[model samples]
Target: MALIDDTRAILGDLIAFPTVSRDSNLELIAYAADRLGAAGARVHIQTDETGHKANLVASLGPETGGGVVLSGHSDVVPVEDQDWSSDPFELREEKGQLFGRGTCDMKGFIAATMAMAPHLGDLDLSRPVHICLTHDEEVGCLGARRLVEEIAGWDEKPSLAIIGEPTEMRIVEGHKGCCEYTTVFTGLEGHGSRPELGVNAVEYAVRYVTRLMELREMLKGRAPAQSRFEPPWSTLQVGRLAGGVAHNVIPGHASVDWELRPVSDADHRFVCEAIAAYARDDLLPAMREISADADIVTHVIGEVSGLEPVDDNEARRIVSALTGANGADVVAFGTEAGLFQKLGMSVVVCGPGSIAQAHKPDEFIEISQLSACLDMLQGLAGKLSTAR
Candidate 1:
């Protein structure tokens, strides 16, 4: 079959699984593993704690050293409440665009790579080529973190990793880190009639949230003079908050779900430490004055480190040579690239489609983009076929 047809067939199979982040992605993993295994590649599967999800690492050619890793996530975001013209799990094409959940955000790249698998064995390669599909990346890069730890223990590691996130086929060198957290406040409740008798948890929660906003501004002021990020600063925001039962009573419990996107690890550490200090020395002390039992607790739910630009990056150079681009770009979104970079591999983000189309109603990827990606991968295969 032609590359386009093969890619579409594989992409359709991937979309049919409905591997949402909330659900198990073993089905998708199994399909990928089967295809890679049939292609004469050595496939390794790593199961997560629940054993319901897994990551697959498949390699073609010799496994000694100096290989390129094409990595993408198997799981996608939820399609709930999104109004689509057709079934989100069914790949539909109209006017040269393929519509489906995960089509743009990911699976397209995976499909293209799988389409190349049948031809890999025919190449006269000096180095190996690896295809790595991970789970739960939409949640917090969970599977990639585990996979990276496993890779760290390997005797042989890839020279470069290219994360197939939606980058419109451009080379992306950097992205900010994301940290998600929740703060819960517990206080004494009483009737609204006695204003001074009760410690209102909702009120304290608001105060804490207000402090977070102030810190957000402070972070804005701390942006590095030469920062390349679009906003040129860290960002903090509260996404969800709830607590009160009745207007006539003082609520005893409240919670806030918030997140931080930092350009640097120092910024991340600063904001986290500042928040903890505020809760301990400023907010919690005031809350406890009303009632000794009053307490504020913060828990970090997720963290994906930012990808910082590095000097002499082989992944960037290879992508630039393939795409014929002069420079790389930066994105506001996070990816598993940083985790791979932490494992001492040169990492770059380059893939088909636009991120603007990702995680939205009627998400889609242009057929032209997929064709371009196939061409790029073919170029990579040609490069790998010759001895370096």
Candidate 2:
């Protein structure tokens, strides 16, 4: 079909930009804004603080309420160490798959949505169709959070939000919320022979990490019996730990990076409070006894709220109707869906490609998957056009 060809062409252009999360994505965002704008959509660009990156929100058809939003992140994970047979930034088609860095992790959905832009102007629609493209999603969904805040201030709120994360075209009803933290432990250094005169930061860091492991177990036990989630429990892990320069010298500084993926807000709060209580009541006393300067500090680095499946979710119903899928799923990885849900918009995570291919080397999306996505968007367009 012509639309499928357009989608592939757009996907190629998008893949060429290499919008890695660590680098600026202004080039890609500008390209998308221009394309969508040229298609007779009203485009609004939300630039980041440095103006090096942006989020694009474009609407077609009516400017009123109760429209559908198609959302996708523009950034891809880094390809620095991955073993790729072809240039990760260059799109290569082999057999029935289109290979590139962002093809599966997402720009495929973005491209498909953009390909449908021209048709939006022609559709005799009652409610508008909105495109929400954000940056920095690979890095803890920072862009989506900002976009959600911007959306919150809009005059006309959308009725539903479909985050085009790779779900193999399945309707994703829920996923876990991820919160990351870095805890720094500081102590007074002294010679190894005079250990009592110095506070050992490494030792205390180990103790704190041990406490985190205990919390992990506590979270595991908090899983609800009726939960549909795989593993069916909230999880915690200390991903990175670094401390101590040399064995002879008493180490004075240590840092540990940890994360919690909570199934519920209560579990999230419980985990945070448990860590704080342990730091305050147990760790601080021992450290202060040696030197007043010794201390522990924890900072939240990244966080994305979890998507809870609602029995009567509007977004889920809309997606199921469009895709003709009666059942929904829960994913282990995080996406921007939760943020939209928090903004009072019903949300579903459904898109082409398998997440198993996401963030891996030689990432590719099957051409058939892209075709399926285009068909789904066309179905949505038909629905919006007749909704009056």
Using TM-score as the measure, the top candidate is 2
Which pairs of residues have clashing backbones in candidate 1? none
lDDT of 1 at 96: 97
Relative to the true structure, how large is the alpha-carbon lDDT of every model?
Answer: 0.91, 0.91
For model 1, the run of ten residues with the poorest summed lDDT: 379-388
Clashes of each: 0, 0
lDDT of 2 by residue, 1-388 (tens): 5999999999999999989998999999899989999999999999999888899998998889888899999999999988999999999999999999999889999999999999987887888889999989878889989998988888988978899999999999999999999999999888999999999999999999999899888888899778988889999998999988888899999999999999998999998888899999999999999999999999888899999988879888877888899899898999988898988788999999999999899999999999999999998888887643
Root-mean-square deviation of every model: 2.1, 1.6
| Predicted candidate 1 versus true structure: per-residue lDDT over 1-388, tens digit per residue | 8899999999999999999999999989888999999998899999999989999999998877778899999999999899999999999999999999999889999999999987887786778888999999989999998999998888888889999898999999999999999999998899999958888889888988998899999998999888899899999999999998998999999999999999888989998898889889987887788899999998878899889898789999988999998899999889999898888789999999999999998999999999989998988988888643
lDDT score, candidate 1, position 288: 81
Alpha-carbon shift of residue 162 in model 1 (angstroms): 0.6
